[model samples]
Target chain A: MPHIDRRIGFMGSGQMAEALAKGLINRGVVTPNQICCTDPVQARKDLFRSFGASSYDTTLEVVHNADVLFVAVKPQYVGAVLTEARPHLTPRHVVVSIAAGITVDMLLDAAGPEAHVVRVMPNTPCLVGETAAAMCVGGKATPEDAELVSTLFSAVGRIYQLDEKLLAAVTGLSGSGPAFVFLMIEALADGGVRAGLPRDVAQALAAQTVLGSAKMVLETGKHPGALKDMVTSPGGTTIAGVHELEMGGVRAAFMSAVVAATNRANELSRMG
Target chain B: MPHIDRRIGFMGSGQMAEALAKGLINRGVVTPNQICCTDPVQARKDLFRSFGASSYDTTLEVVHNADVLFVAVKPQYVGAVLTEARPHLTPRHVVVSIAAGITVDMLLDAAGPEAHVVRVMPNTPCLVGETAAAMCVGGKATPEDAELVSTLFSAVGRIYQLDEKLLAAVTGLSGSGPAFVFLMIEALADGGVRAGLPRDVAQALAAQTVLGSAKMVLETGKHPGALKDMVTSPGGTTIAGVHELEMGGVRAAFMSAVVAATNRANELSRMG
Candidate 1:
């Protein structure tokens, strides 16, 4: 894909905004002069400036200065941010919201009917160009707008397009999934540490194992079970590990976690 | 570190052996001529040939032709294979064994007193240049021999040097940890499918999330909890998902899973 060089604006200067901005700059997808950010908090503006991007004091100013508007404020403040920036949202602009729990319909409703809005749920790893992000097109978003959003996200990591209804599950699995994985890695490292490996060595081993295994799934396109069976000899150590995971009901716990997050997303959508 | 090419000899042509050989060749760390694998099974020998490596008819021929010998046979037959190869083994040759539940002492005894033997536990992802492998030096192996083993393993992924006692835990965590992670990814992908995302898309998302998150911990050098906190905004979608994970005891279940694997590894070590 060609470099996008989009004139992008963010309504918040939080981690998500910074991550996106950094991804854009790192990938040469967007120039510093082409990006503008605003946050009510002065500290956030300072953070934005550290990326060599322009910063404004208010959302309206950011929206007025860019062709693409990213509504990256907290979900609780989305309504106010949208209302404040509404005047600056012109017909040529595409509005994308990274606000968690904010639905496409809500984004459309707040940003105006004609706004080409899209809702994206991106995980924390976006800061490192390895994020798993899912996008849902708003009622008014064109295929072009969706493609543009995807191009921007591709600079960070893989991007998925799904119906708005599935965004919550994305929020649960990928957005929140990192924490679960981190905890697992930490626990595994602790197990290694307990087994008498140095802390750094154990941590690195545990982490590299996770990274390599995930890559196996993606690169091979094999069923996880089939790929797993390949690793596990009959009565080997892998089967022993699988036996423990089965005994502990790991599958059920993760299932429940995703379901709970999806249900909460629905609740937040309804509240809006 | 200088690029050290290891002349690896595999005493079996099974999946794990072939995977390791392919891993070495794929990374250009070992040339096709440098690797000699032996298997009585004709089909397995053919499979090894297709991977651009030479195959021999007997363990003696392979052990005689190589600097490092890997005993990759099933644990039940490892003693027989080691006995067959012991006559060709010399003090200059480093014998490494990947047979699960086999001990360094067992391997050393089979290869004889003068032989430099090492015990390694490697996962299946090694086939893709991302294996997590743990190695423990035996009584006769020198630091130079250990460094050579590390060099060979670096082609696949991260290699750790640990006391022989911890090989079982390494076996449990990484040797079997891939299956545990595969199950988690599969379960999460199913949850995404349940929430209306297509199967392939959901699988990709779940797999990539696991991969990216693991990379974050390895590269960022921060505590997993710190990275988790960075991603999660208060009461946001991630926090909502995290709450569900906590409620479902995801952390506890995962911890127990690792503990179960580690304990099982310890048990297997005792059996050996």
Candidate 2:
């Protein structure tokens, strides 16, 4: 894919906004000088400025200055931000929203049906060049618009295209899944501590184990169950531990967590 | 800091031994010519030889030819293998054992007390250049000997030095933790499937989520809880899913899995 050479801007200079901007800039996908943003918060604006990007005070100002505008505000504020910027958004602009629970229909509704809109649910791992982002095109979004947005996010990590309806499920799996993993790492470290290992070493080992195992799945293109079976010998320590994980219903809980979160995402959309 | 310059050999040409050898050669840290192994299995010997390394029928031939030898036999066969090769193992050779549940004392006792030995617990991710391995030096092993083994294994993945007693915990957490992580990914993928995503996309997202989250924990130098908080907005989707996870005692189950595996590792050692 080609680099996103057009000017880009963000409506909110928050964590997600900064992550996207930083990832794009660091990967040389979009130059820092080609990026700009607006935020009420001084700290966030200052952080944006540090990346060699200019800052504005209002969403309309950012939309006017850039060709590709990103609305990185919270879900509730997405409506107001996009609606306000809708007036300034020209046909040249592609508006991408990273707000949680905000749908493509919502973006199209808020920012005029004529506006090119993309709804994205990107996780925090963008800070580490490993984000798993999902994007959905709106009524007016062109193939070029979708490609531009996907290219922008891919600099941070992998990007998947899905139906807007599946965005909530994406939220549940990739967005919320990280927290579940963090909790698991914490528990694994605690388990190591219980087994007489020092806290730091245990934590390091736990985090790396997850990272490595995940890499095995992604790189090898093998089934997780097959990988798990390979690790579990006829009567080995991994199998013993696996037995406990199975008994504890770890799988069911994760499945339910996603279901509950997806349900909540649907509710938030309905509340809007 | 330097790569292992000596000829290395593996007693068992199994999956792990091949993973290490392949990782080292692929990384260009050690040439395939520097690695040799002996296994009764003809297929295993052919695979090892395909790497441009020599293979032998007897462990004694490998022990005599290589300066740094790895004993990759099963836990139960570690004593017999080492005892059989002990007489041929000259003072110039440093023996590294990756046999689970076999301690330094057992290696020292089985192979003469003067034999230089190091016990390592390495996981399957070594095949992916992201393995989390732990090594403990034996009484007769010198600092140089420890460095050689560590350098050799580091080519395949990261290695940490710890006391011998903690290897069992390492076995529980990292050694067995990959299997637990695979289960989590499977569950997380199932969650996505339940939410209406295609299986392949869901699995990719689940695995990448874990990988990206782990990278954030490792690279950001922030606590996982703090990182989780960074992603969780007030009244957001992530927190809702997290609540369900907490209610499910998912963390406790993972902790218990590690502890159960650690206890099993200790038990296996005791059984020996």
Candidate 3:
């Protein structure tokens, strides 16, 4: 990964945008002084300014100044913001959208044919420096443009290069998946409380278990099934617990959650 | 956290013993020669030896030489091993047991009243330097003794101090819980795959989401429900997906898994 020193700007200053800006500056990818963002909401603009970043009231100022401009607004606002900044966007500028259900073609249409557009679907884990984010290249996006976008998001988490068609699936899985895991951790903690452990300790242990197991999967590069088997010693407690998860249909539920979310994303984009 | 320089020894040189030896040596708590272990299997002994730890074929040698002695044998073998090493065990030695269902009281009974006994239930993620481990002090153990054990395990992962009565809950939640998480992550990956993402990419994203979300829960110290709400906007993909998870009984299933595993741990200890 190249060390990015370019000025990064955002068209919105929501939590997602702040997560990226804070992550970039914290990792020394870019300093706060190198970050500038635009937001109509005074409080949102003030929020970004708290990180030592410059804030603007209009989108064109951000588009004109920054080398990489992030379109981080709501899905419904992407077209309007892109159109407002269309005249200022240059071929050298990379416009990346973090808004869900916003298509690369729609962004390209609003920003003009020469502008480089990259679409991203990032989960809230970006705030914790462990986000799972995916990016898609637009019609005019160069390989360098894709690299730059990946590098920016990579500062916060793992980045996957994706096709526009597959971005909805990414939205459904990693995008909405954090909430599911949070719920599971919460429920696991509840079980611990019921079993006689203190609330705080159980939550801590449950969260750590999820964090560690996820890391084991990435670090070992072994199959998850193999790792699960490693812990399940024949007729042991782990196997017994696994039987409950299986019988409770956890696997099917998670599968359906992603599918349902993906269909919802597809519908939103279609409506847009 | 005091830096532990005491000589550490393992009575059983299995994967658990190797993990501790390697972690202690890696963290510079004790040098390779300062660590010693006894095991019947040559391969297991060789594994610890690779980390500069001395290998012995008898349990008495490990109990005699080290200031902190770890009894890492199987549950059925813990009593016999402790009984054989009882005469060699002194007041200065802190005898720790990592075997499941082997209570601190049982260890105290085998090793006699003078030795300090501590019991731990740690998940397999200790191998990745991010384990969830809990320790309980026996009748003869002092606060300093607990501190030493906590510092030792803390080198590889997070440690929680609890009563011996709560160890079964720890076993079910964090001990056997890693397997439950691996299954959930695999199931989440399966969901991602069903939603049209590639198998490897889907698995990677799913694992990262779990890892990141877990970090969020620990770092933010906020309620998991609040964190879930932070990601879920009105009519957004996350909320839509969360609804599916709610409909699918994910929380109930995870709660049942932990409860079942805890019950199993209680039963196993009773049978022992």
Task: Name the best candidate (by DockQ).
Answer: 3
Q: What is the lDDT of residue B225 in candidate 1?
A: 79
TM-score for predicted model 2 compared with the true structure: 0.92
Which ranking of candidates, highest DockQ first? 3, 2, 1
Against the true structure, whose TM-score is highest? 3
The 10-residue segment with the lowest total lDDT in model 2 chain A: A1-10
lDDT of 3 by residue, A1-272 (tens): 45687889998888889899998988778889889998888998898888799998788888777989998888889889989888887777888888888788888888888888888888889988889999888868899889888888888999999888998899999999989999999999998998899999999999999999999999999889999999998777888889998998998888888988888889888988
Please provide, for model 3 over B1-272, each residue's C-alpha lDDT reduced to its tens digit, 9 standing for 90 to 100. Answer: 35577889898888778878888778877678889988999998888777678888788777777889888888889999888988887778898999999887788889898879999898899988789999988858899999999999987889999988899999899998889888988988998899899999999999999999999999999889899988887887888888888888888888888888999999999988
Model 2, span B1-272: residue lDDT tens: 35567898899989899998998888777888898999889999999988799999888889878998889887778889989988887889888989888888899998888899889999989878888889998858899888877788888778899998899999999999999999999999999999998999999999999999988888887888887887777787788888888888888888889888999999999887
Number of backbone-clashing residue pairs for each candidate, in the order shown: 1, 0, 0
How far residue B74's Cα lies from its native spot in candidate 1, in Å, is 2.6
The per-model DockQ list reads: 0.52, 0.77, 0.83
Residue-level lDDT of model 1, residues B123-203, one tens digit each, is 877877788888998868999999988888787787888887777677766777788788888988877777667889888
Q: What is the descending TM-score order?
A: 3, 2, 1
Residue A210 CA displacement from its true place in model 1, Å: 2.8
**Ten residues in sequence with the least summed lDDT for candidate 1 chain A:** A232-241
Q: What level of docking quality does candidate 3 show?
A: high
